[model samples]
Target: MAYCGNIRQEGCGKLERREKYRLFLYVLLIGSITALFICWMILIWEKIPGAIHIRAGIRQDLDLNVPVSGKLYKAPAETEDGAIPVTGMNAAVDAREAKTLSVDLAEPLTLYAEDIETYTMDLKLFGLIPFKTVNVQVINDKTLIPAGIPIGIYVKTEGILVIATGDFTGDDGQAKEPVGHLLKEGDYILKVNGREVEGKAAFMRQIEESNGEELVLTILREDQEFDLKVRPERNQDGEYKLGIWIRDNAQGVGTLTYLDENNSFGALGHGINDMDTATLMNLKNGSLYTTEIVSITKGENGTPGELTGVIDYKESNKMGTIEANTVEGIFGELNESAASHITTQAMPIGLKQEVDLGPAQILCSVGGAPQLYDVKITSVHLDHDNINRGIELQITDKTLLETTGGIVQGMSGSPIIQDGKLIGAVTHVLVQDPTRGFGIFIENMLIQ
Candidate 1:
């Protein structure tokens, strides 16, 4: 009986030992998973921006919202003088530990150079672990005269633009699609039967003279040129036509943004898209004319209004010659005589990084004369894909909101000033909310 009792006791002890061992294995597995999860979170938290830019003679504070303490050190850069640290930007300390890194770039109180200079710095977490390496760019500031006066823009397309292809009633009293798949909207007809087309009038004459003959049409679509064969159809009125609508030129009225010391100017804040195709017009040549505001149309929800202006297309009313039409705006040289008549004061331009989210002013000519109106910058998106929409603003001036019912169509390119500096220009107004709009940074226009 004693031996049996001993055997039972041994079995019970072995079972107890096995259970404890299983519990130990479970605890070990749980601890390993928790440690890995914490490490992953730390890595995600450390993904901070790697570079920053600042203009010379301006003070800015940069904050890196890392939870732990970190220190900044001057990183060596390879320049013409070899690996060295640039002292142009002054900071409080070369190395210091802090919970949330904030860099106060207040040194070099004056303009440093006429060109852009780059510097580098290194950030370390807890003065030990690697953080981020930052590249600091300091550029020379520029000054420009913000010109908000109204102007008329006219541009001749590179070639005869095809607006649309349609079927026409033929002389046989039947519908005829002469164009077929030969051409489409937004395509530019460069040549007809080996002859370069100059204007719509010349193109119409060529088609009429074809007399139902198959003609070779050279088409330009999206930077590619191709040839197509099509025969003109005779309408019931005995008129020969290609069954296509075409345009050769476009015109509109818009505000001028700025004038540089050299009389160079940028206007319209955005490109002129075709009304039918909505594509950027290919510019062959264009001109700017002086405009007289005749009347105003108040904007309402879901419908944008415009400024009615009378532009005399005469040599005496020529303001400038437009050289390029781009997504940023139109660039050209102001007529010397017209430049002398501008009475606006030149102000220093503010870089995109310097723009703040607060009160600002926009110079626009609602009446016959240009005037400054109050606005508020609601948002600023740095590194935006659409450069023209870097800043979003809301009209706050009661007089402006009452006069035009917010930003109108012709108000584009109105200069947006903040802190007495030229920051940006109005580019687009929200159709759903005319009181709000988007702007392009002045630096973008200047770079173009």
Candidate 2:
């Protein structure tokens, strides 16, 4: 009986051991699966694609307004104060003879006249027919015209005087002692000493009477007003002179080379120049004009891109110029004269529905830097926005990318075509990773 009992006990122990082993196996299997899943997730996190980087350059034809020194006139007072009673104070020229009339401001405390009660001062030419009428206006009793009031005038001007004193350098790279700092291309002369000069003649007369003495000039820079003491120098002709030139006007146009799929239209792939000083023009008030894409000059390695075109003055009727370009390009309203067909079409604004990783094309002109060419979409990231993200495009169109380093300047706004649909506009190009770039979803641009 004892042997049988011992046998039963051993058998039960064996069964219990077998059950424990089975449970161990089940736990081992689950642990392995969980570990494998964690490893897979880590790999995916590392392999996920990044963002897209793009570089864009846009060009547009522009007509800039150059501000010239007009005249200082005594605007009349509107109220019962000591203010002068004046009228019309607008910049104007004789429509018939093209003569400029000058009016002097008899008062000193007034800055400018109010717009409501302005009058026109008639001037007699050769003491016969009035050649020009000056615009003059009155000021309110509370408001006072600052020390210097800009007067408007019309004259056949040549260049401007660039005055500089102190230790200055010349274009020849040589140092020379300056006379009084003369008028620069961008400086607006407001007054000479305390006397109010009306026109260039009066300015010249004041200088002649000063006899080469140090003169105080109130000039307007940016928006703030300041004063500078300039002493005129005697030239070889024994005439007192300020190194300045006068310019009449300027006119030019460029192509609408690029469009930010994210923004509407941009312009001036570059900046404007002051012909007199050969420097970038210091802009005050300027406007943009629309033009037809006449032609383009392709860019090469080391060379810059340029768009050549004629101004669409007729379209200019509908065109609007930009007020500022400091932000992401310049923004402006379109004119009714804009191409009805182009303006009527809907523009792409944000990310496209689905861009295929196959083939695409760009719309640009020959001689223009951004030439349309066939390229292969190597990969399309499902979601990405970084500079290294976005779509991966290969230069399958060897000729285009070769002539222009994959994507060149002034090609920022070129339309990207894929599967007979507009995808997005090129926004950036990776300098180090030239083969890769970024684009803004066409849908994103339309929002504005």
Considering every candidate listed, which one attains the maximal TM-score?
Answer: 1
Question: What clash pairs does model 1 have?
Answer: none
Distance from true location, Cα of 101 in model 2, Å: 68
Residue 22 lDDT (model 2): 93
Clashes of 2: 78
Residues 1-448 of candidate 1: C-alpha lDDT, one tens digit per residue = 9999999999999999999999999999999999996796465333333344556665544443343333333234423432222333333333343211233222231212223555555555544555556555666668899999999989999989999999989999999999887788999998988888989999999999887899999999999999999999899999999899999999999999999999999998888889999998998899999998889899999998789889999999999999999999999999998898789999998867678999999998977779999999998765566778889999999999888989999999999999989999999999999999999988878666
lDDT score, candidate 2, position 419 = 63
lDDT of 2 by residue, 93-151 (tens): 33443233333222221123333343344433333533333444332221100000000
Deviation in angstroms for 237 in model 2? 4.3
Off by over 4 Å in 1: 1-139
